[model samples]
Target: MGKLGKRTVAAREAFAGKENLTVEEAVSLIKASANAKFDETLEIAMNLGVDPRHADQMVRGVVGLPNGTGKDVRVAVFARGPKADEATAAGADVVGAEDLMEIVQGGKIDFDRCIATPDMMPVVGRLGKVLGPRNLMPNPKVGTVTMDVAEAVKAAKGGEVQFKVEKAGVIHAGIGKISFDDKKLVENVRAFVNAVSKARPSGSKGAYLKKISLSSTMGPGVSINVDNAVAE
Candidate 1:
């Protein structure tokens, strides 16, 4: 491995021996250690007890962070007629039907979130192979597949975050930015934890939330006490 940079070394030293911290403590530590040139995103990772291989064991949901994610979210909408105009007015970065699919198929997906009206699913469905792997497929469960194009567009550009457990039973997402106030970060963390807690599948056995960690884009991660994280 290459020599560790000064910032990374310092961050690791500060995080040494820290574990099972409260949400606030973890957020503070992560924020303090985020010294990258650009504003670093505050990320959260949760390890759950259930494997996602089984349909019933899957944990997937969306949460709107109390404090919007610091990054600008580019939204692409699949709609037509008035709904298309609504999406554009609400700030969608891209909007279309077959034309959008062709663009996506041509490997030109430039947006972060994708929204589709219910009637546009057929067109969106054809891009499943292209969008599903990236977790960009518009799903009704998360309200991305809906008739309310305007609300969906606004939410996407806002702070809405969608999370799905990986095969190894881990869910990861950016909760906010290190520059956010500690209180806002904590609130975002709690809101996310609560959403995941509520999304616990019936098939989950023993402990639903096995572990949780908070980290910045270029900083070392700190473990958070699962109970404290969910305690509101």
Candidate 2:
């Protein structure tokens, strides 16, 4: 295809054969494909009739993607002491409980995520109405609720990265941006996979990491096969 023709072409290509593509091919495909797109995603279909549900359990931690999830994470860091000052200095959209409630009531601050020091947790409880239904309230399962102000602030400004086993038992997540180099995206994905695989609940049955896939912002998700995700 000519340059313009290829440019207009959909980037999606099926993962053919049992053989895995080289790193070069993988990265080139992700970067070149302009057809990438996203939908409100859900569980990964790993196999026929084997919809897995233990993905959330294998979560390592939710990280703030430095540039956001290609979108802004209206972070509300809850704190009211020395930690409060710390959070503000770190560039958090800092809020004390009183201010937090007012913001919520005004419907002005639609926070994408909430990070709080242990000191702020008690007060955060008061705003359950404002945060819970939206899934904006951070949970310990993903390490958003913490005593460390520095970590909280950093993670808050960071992207809201979550890991979970989709129905296919495949771990799915958005690692980084399409503008990011393939190696970096691969690295990010690799790191995430490692963390999640390590955190696999001991209670889980059978082998973990049924498969893997990587895609871009507006393109179809092309899979990264997992012959042995644990091995690497």
Candidate 3:
């Protein structure tokens, strides 16, 4: 059997016997254990109690992390005329109409967040098969499809994060980087939890938030108390 490295052993020792800790404690533990050469992203995963197969039970929404995600979000906008200019002026990395569609159709999608004007949906809809699977489809519910291109671009470039529950009823996203201070990380974590709590679908019954876990890019995950995570 291959022996565990010293860093792994130390990380496990630090996390020993620590289960279901408060949000703050879990963040601190995760940050401390992140000793990788690259800046580690602090990720949060929440197990929810809803089957997304049913339309009404789907859990998906956007939240502006109080302390930014500590990562640059690439934004692409589908618009024309003044709206396209507005997007470019607002710092959209890529902006176009059918041209953007062609780029995506050629399998050269390079942006993270995608936005679209209401009129551009006809063109954007054609790429649903490609973008939908990547969670980059523009939807009004998530503020990615609207006439206000500038604000949307700013929000995307800012700390706004969109989360959608997976097949296993789990929602996961990186809240921030380990380089972030403790206060910022805690604030971002709480903001995310509160957003998910508020997005609770009516179809969901008991225990909407079943479990919450925190971990760095290269470290082991540590479970956090659901109650503590939901507390304002």
Candidate 4:
């Protein structure tokens, strides 16, 4: 491995010997050690006990962070007529039908979130190979595929976050930015954890939430006490 930078080294040293910390403590440590050029995103990772390969064990859900994700979210919507206009008026960065599909297919996916009205699915469906891999497909389960385009667009721009357990049985997402107040970060962390806890799959056995951790874009991670994280 290459030599560690000063910032990385200090962050690692600061997190040394820390484990199973309360949500508040974990957020504080992560925020303090986030000494990067830009405002680093505060991220959370939960190790779930479900094997997603099994349909019954899959875990997926969305949560709107109380403090909002510090990053601005660009939204794309697939709709026509009033729904299309509603999405645009609701601050969607891009809205369209086949025109939007052509843009996405042309390798110009510039949006962070995507929403689609039911009627537009046939057009959006063709881009499954393009959007599915990036987890940007509008799925009904997550409320991205709905007739309520305005609300969906608003939510996407207002800190809504979707999370699905990966093959490794881990759910990861950015909760906020290190620059946010400690209290806001704490609230976002708990809200995210609770959402995941509620999304536990039926086939999940043993301890559903195995572990939780908090970290910054350029900092070392700190494990959080599962009970403390899950506590309301």
Clashing residue pair totals per candidate (backbone < 3 A)? 0, 14, 0, 0
For lDDT, the strongest prediction is 3
165 in model 3: Cα distance from truth in Å?
0.5
Preferred candidate (TM-score higher): 2 or 4: 4
Q: Write the per-residue lDDT of candidate 2 for residues 159-197, one digit (tens) a residue.
A: 557654544445555656666655555555555556665
Please provide TM-scores, in order, for all candidate models, with all chains considered together: 0.98, 0.71, 0.98, 0.98
Q: Which 10 consecutive positions of candidate 4 have the poorest summed lDDT?
A: 27-36
Residue-by-residue lDDT tens digits, candidate 3, 4-82:
9999999999999999999899988888889999999999999999999999899999999998999989999999999
- Kindly state the number of residue pairs that clash in model 3: 0
lDDT of 1 at 198: 99
* 3 or 4, greater by lDDT: 3
- Model 4: per-residue Cα lDDT at residue 66: 92
* Candidate 1 lDDT by residue in tens digits, 97-158: 99999999999999999999999999999999999999999999999999998998888778
Which pairs of residues clash in candidate 1, taking residues 3 or more apart in a chain or in different chains? none
Runs of candidate 4 with Cα error greater than 4 angstroms are none
State model 1's lDDT: 0.93
Off by over 4 Å in 1: none
Candidate 4: residue pairs that collide: none
The whole-model C-alpha lDDT of candidate 3 against the native structure comes to: 0.95
